[model samples]
Target: MDWQAHARTLAAQIVRPESRWFEPLATTPRHTLVPRWWDSVDGQWALQDGARDPGRWLDVVYSDRTLVTRVGPVHADAAAPGTVVDGLPTSSSTLPGLVVQMFQHAVIDDDTSQVLVTTGSGYGTALACQRLGEQRVTSIDIDPNLVATARERMNLLRLRPDMKVCDVTGKLPGAYDRIVSTVSVRPVPASWLALLRPGGRLFTTIAGTGLIVTADKTEDGGAVGRVTPDPAGFMRTRQADDYDNPTREVWEKAQHADGDSVSVSRYPLLYVPDSWAVMSMLALDVPGIDHRVHEDGDQRTVWMLHPDGSWARATSGGFLEGPTVHQGGPRRLWDALERIRNRLNREGQLPVYGARVTIAPDGETTLSRGGWTVTL
Candidate 1:
């Protein structure tokens, strides 16, 4: 297959020819790096092998979309045909557009600037290595198998960077002038601040929110920056092969039970997952909400569960009508959401975006925009 032609098409679609990232995206073989992936078909895992059908493979690989390379602990490369497993996505080759966005946010401008990048499918690292010399990039992941396999894939492309297996929140492999993570982080990491040079920038999305934080290191080892107007949602960093859902029982109980108190909500029964802005603001205020949606015939139900034994269920007529809200446990999860949504509707915007962020040397983060401020 003429992969270069497809790559060129992808580059043109996402960037201009004069852009610094155009040539790298136009030449890198994403198909070679991610030959197999899983596509969710009817909520079930469906494996897609590139070699089995070169046409479909090149079409998907060259497209500006994320490809799931692993679910739970099952890597697509190792899964048998028609194999199905129930688990969340553990790793992926992030969409080329978002990869470029993350790198561009960090301003990885020079070949001499040492960069630290998160390694998932390693396609992102390839782009970074292409932009900055291979010796200038250090790639890391929590999974050893991923690190090893990605290293092998890099050699196949004649692009070798420093690849290692380590939890991104812990001790890093080396100091860097720039750090860009494809994974989400919470409160930021002190290690990142300690490792970055003064004036060096760090870019990452906040956990449970699509907010992008761009902070530059200060001389005192802290960083000050703002939540850029970019929206990105990446899986959070994991310390193990798979993630654990601690709020499953709370969801089960909340899903079928009548609430301790029931009333009509002032808002419609909107699917929380589909509303990024509302979901993000709620996450900042409430945090750790396990959102679930169920639709039956002409009725719809939205379930919000928290590990704190708090659960809220809202049933709607599925016709833009207000929902009957039922809430239980220590906190009123839906009530908190409504409060945030109320502010959004009242003020045309939320403070989570374009908010100035101050990160202490210990990774304590405080975000402030105008009179609104929050600590996470």
Candidate 2:
């Protein structure tokens, strides 16, 4: 099937030599983990079950991209061949490149520091098992079926990493020298700190935003690290079957609701996902600013909202000039976005990745820079 050739090409394009994950990216057999996967078609994500067409399956399996394994709560394997699941992606094995990037920051060593990684499609677990012996690794996922499938796949490769179905946002299972999460978290869980031995390290992505934090546990029961230069996004941990579906409601409110909530914007059309520095600043200053983007034939819309009754809607009409922005509520959404842009423009700075993180003994994380502090 020329699987090695396909993997080699995809790896070359995504994995850099400077990355610590070069070996895993080059050696792990990604084609085996995702033989068939769903593809986006006509604005909906569809699936091609592995047992179907070997040719089409191999191409998808080796491609350096994400594949949706579950829609809502239904696993792709349970669906018929060529079936389309028009629901939000509830589970996925992240692309090999991004997985490697997360692992690159993990900084696994030859020492016998037990490693813990979140299991989704089991691909990341396989890579960890490959780097450190399977015995030294433990991988967990909230979905029982996913953990079961991942365990089977690891066994297929004759590896034996401990597998469990557990929510990483809550209490972790055991003590570890290193903890790395593929799933994102809103706040660095205090349970995670308790799970780490003194001097242990953690590499993880922030939930609801594109930020990666790598911190080391201190003797005083706290941690500290700076944001990474790269932008990485992962599925936020879900306590329920599905997220509350707030986007539609928010959009409808914006279209219908009106009030005399005057506000002066802080910033411009700063696409949070595109700009790491601004994204970091927003996340640091105002934690939990949810963003979503939808694109049509010629129009693109980016919506920004916060739990604090703040909302901003920006739309690009037909690929023309500046976007039309409508912002309302107690806090001016556009103003905040513009404020961030202005700070970057005037002071030639944005405090995000470079901002210092201080995890207090009480589990409060505060980002501070230039006499400004944001409690997260």
List, in order, the clash count of every candidate structure: 0, 11
Model 2 segments more than 4 A misplaced: 9-23, 256-271, 293-300, 306-309, 316-320
TM-score of each: 0.98, 0.87
Clashing pairs in 1: none
Over 84-148, each residue of candidate 1 has an lDDT whose tens digit, in order, gives 87789999999999999888888888744799999999999999988888999999999999999
Report, for every candidate in turn, its global Cα lDDT versus the true structure: 0.90, 0.75
RMSD of each: 1.1, 3.1
Q: What is candidate 2's TM-score against the reference?
A: 0.87
Task: Tell me model 1's lDDT, rounded to 2 decimals.
Answer: 0.90
